[model samples]
Target: MSKLEHAELVDGVREELITYLQNGTVNKQAVARTLDITELGIDEIDRLKRIHFCLSSDVVDFIETLQGRLRRIKTANQRDREITRGEVRGGIDWQATTRVRYTESAGDRTRFACKTPYTEYDIGENLVLKKLLWLVHSTVQEDISDINYDWRREAWPTERIAMFDRIYARNVHLNRIRDGEDIRVTRRMLNTARTARQSLYTDAYRLYDRYRRLLAGKYEDEDVSQLLSNTLVIPERLPRLFELFCIFQLLRCLSSRGLRLQPIESGAKQLAILESDQYTVDIYHDQNGGLSFHVPLSELEGIEADYIDRYQNVQRRHGELVDAFLGNDTQPSLFSGRPDLVLEVYESRAREVLTAVVLGEIKYSDNQQTFTRGLEELLKYIEFAQYEEYLSDLDIDIQGLIISDGVETNRDSPLDGEVTHISASDLISVGYPESWIPTQIR
Candidate 1:
């Protein structure tokens, strides 16, 4: 298959796998049917199932750890508040008589209108516990929803069912707090709830342990043993994880270069600002960098009318790179293409001047074909930026780079001259140099 075709196949498989893992009902049969329809061989399907189990197991482990930590969190001292009601009484609030009403017929009767207050223990730890419980509940529910396997049959071990039930009950009890169920009225009841947290963790641990033991035991078929082994491999999540990993790595590099990195607080975009004493860099992801341009209609007199028309048509159709040339508007065109990452450099001191803009693409796959396709795409973006006169008019040089797992590139490749292909690790280790910022643009 061609590289593009293979990438599409990988993406399709990933979506199916994600859907299967998130399904609340563990419907393995459904997933098997889907895989069969895709024409994946039995072996391939089995491998994918094993990977699903491994990732799901990791999630279970995470919840187990979180619950354990919740159990260990030191309980806070309980505070008591005086409250008064009919029949139940505590210390009197002499200053507040609104709750007291005297009846003429039942004058001076203690039962009729007694000013009293009772101390109710308020355990602050319950709030923490409730929040932690909610986290556990939500995490489990999400994981369960992803599961495409049905566990109604005896095929699923009894222990798993029991463990899930215990956790679900805990979630329900905590959820009831919003519905007037008090979790901290009495000391004994509060203590019991605290202990239940530990018990839940223990039950979950044992359930996972049982699975591990079962997998460890020798099976009649070697293939079955291999397939059921505890080892888990998930390539589907790698690309996104790699992207995040790069973001943080770049953050660290920029920090090392005496720049303070702050995430932009705008809801419309996910971007970060790297500020130094004299300069700033705006990191944009999957957005147009919030730029627009205005050009004088007369500028089209020099350029071909058809070419200008085509450019304007393309700009309107894509809403990406806007018209950067020939206009009083200082902003560049909204870039038509959304790269994985974009860095816009500026001089922060005195006058805020845009120095350069860098576009980047990330490819996590080690496959040569995938790397080539990504490189081509990166080159195309660079070409658009370079050939577009409007982009040049912005007075900022445009550069592009591809971050990928190590891949060999041809020396004569067009990308070799304009775009840099750097391993993700190396890029993180060595900070991106200022030289990469085109001096000519400044």
Candidate 2:
């Protein structure tokens, strides 16, 4: 390995990750999970040891802006009045009945009825209420309340945690909105609040817009994983960091090929789709059960026979892998197989791979031993995929690749099968993912 290969402070790693985020739309949840793929052990030190209140700057802006505006929120009111014999308000309605019936009393006395048009500052004020509720009940707010010992908070020092507690409680309480009031957060209501034309509300809307932009993965030059992790989650280990570097490098490669990120419908895997006129590529990292394509051992008879046939065809010193020897109880037969990284490509409209399956392993070192080990792993994964159950149901072809720093590799492969291995060092010398996987468009 080169002196700089896994050096203490790896240059360009964080910068590379940040550049990728700035360039493409990614699965944020998946990104979050990947950047924090560390677990605690009884003997090993954990990453999340230094835990303090952490929120993005945008989150701070959303909380503080709302906190400042809540004090002077302008109320938009819509109200009406009616005739009453009580006190005079909003002027009396002249057309309303002026006659009043006296209550049953010892002395017969007559009272006057005054129809009044009193304005209740409800509708317009409720607009602000609707806007407030809309923002307060959003995922943004849920994210905060999720972490708060109680409620509202920010990194701001003017007023500390107690101040946040008061503000958050007050905001949720929403004293501006009365109990039993009808408050609906409709698009029209939001538009009304947004276009309220008041400086206070307009400022509130500005903060709202900023917050939304931040939520949409628009952090200028910030490494989101680091920003959120606070020196924790972003792996300090060289190998792990290299793994993330590789994944992002893959994302950039796919992004260049018109990759569109699909929102994760369920779990923490980053799933993306790359489509072309002829086919669609489904890119998944950690898949269902951590294997994008897997299969059982029983489905491998034809594939095993293929290997045996290849061994027979090729001029080799080894004898044939006869069925009796392969399946004898003297040794246990292999059962199932899966790979490390995956990019599943098929037809544009089809759900299965009609062409071929390309298997690859990512290695961070340039040393021969690491390279050879990675190749062996890749060969096994690829070779086994040819024999797996779920995949065996469909017609399949298999190829292999090993992405490494550089290797004096002898190109060990299956009987007659040759796997392509490339150096990822091209990322620095040539371009991104600079090495090519077998199935890549290029």
Candidate 3:
């Protein structure tokens, strides 16, 4: 493999290891073992090691605390389920009422309502509380991860650590229930655990696993896999891989999974709103009664004119060159004036592809970045759609080009048939300021 390819693989592995090891889940040793790298090389080795030690030592103690709370709920569950003469009652009861909760606190005279599943009351609040307790109990049995740690809090630096402590506590409660001891205690433990689990789900762990899994499949192709494993992977250079995956997954989740994004009921051609990682494209009607497309370059670096001057110049020149080629060899179509310029250089060809389009996506980033799974997905969609065939059938010979920031490679691809992929370096070195491409690049 070339030096660039080797660099990309190393980078990808480094980032993956960092994410897993530093994210409070795995120990440094585990990370090092997985990557087959020396543990000493990990910069935060000591810190991660300490965290692992603390978690292992305190896990049991934390579980006990959570189990105590669960025991109370379990006791209430047995009492609540006792069938009355004809009524199936399930509700919380104010087990005991005290005239005061704390003598030292302000307004200590306020009444204290110690609540549990109702044994007598049929009021809405009691019934709801009873049902809630049952629901929480069931949830604990089903998912200990749903345990609520909200009743516990700590200062900023230690907040996450404290939350983990709370999670461990709930696990203890779950263990009691699983062991079938102190049913009421288990019930209460489950209730608290349910609340904690819900809070954790909504507030934390934003399902990054989904993205990881979806992206994982994209690199399964032997070439990309080998490239990533042995090189320092730079995502920006080959954004097509990642971009296409995101689009495919986003569309799948939104359209098939019944996400909020939906088409209009009327005959309007709206499909769904798409969320993008690096950029977004919106299509709508123009002011002149013609179709218009909007491809936002927000969040893209190198947008300042001077930085992209060379890129744009090369792109324009590449366009002229392609035109000259078609003019000389391929006959021009009879319908449109200057058959649509399919590929044009915009700027930067060292490490990433940078291209501008009249009606398509134009990605801008510095340096060559390796291709990602997202790009593969996008390419697959285009291929399966038989984009070229569609264009040919319509008598429109639309050319598709990928202008990359790196050196244009002669890498073999199952996908690249009529669609051309060129590095910005190739376009500038050969095609820029000229009406013909270097035979080497083509």
Runs in model 2 deviating more than 4 A are: 1-54, 65-69, 76-91, 99-162, 171-173, 178-199, 210-270, 275-280, 288-337, 345-348, 351-353, 363-376, 386-397, 404-417, 420-425, 428-442
- Residues 34-90 of candidate 2: C-alpha lDDT, one tens digit per residue: 544332221111112112122445435555555656666554434354434445555
Q: What ranges in model 1 sit over 4 Å off?
A: 1-135, 138-235, 266-270, 291-336, 349-352, 386-389, 410-417, 428-442
lDDT of 3 at 391: 25
**Candidate 1: Cα lDDT at 7:** 43
Best model number under lDDT: 2
Worst 10 residues of 3 by lDDT: 283-292
Please give each candidate's TM-score.
0.46, 0.55, 0.21
- Which lDDT tens digits does candidate 1 get at residues 1-442? 1122324334333432333233311133323332332123322333444333433544355444543354344334333344333553544444332334343322332333334433222233344344334434443344333443443112223454356546546643333343222332344444444455555433433333333332443223333333333222222344544554454456556666677755334242434566777777776655446332233344444566787777656545443333334333322242335567777777873425666777778887667888878877776565555323545556666776677765655531243345666665465345433334444222
Where is the poorest 10-residue window by lDDT in model 2? 42-51
Please tell me which model should have the higher lDDT, number 2 or number 3. 2
Candidate 1 lDDT at 163 equals 62
lDDT of 3 by residue, 146-212 (tens): 2233221211124444444454345543333322222222334334434443332211112112212
Q: Rank the candidates by TM-score, best first.
A: 2, 1, 3
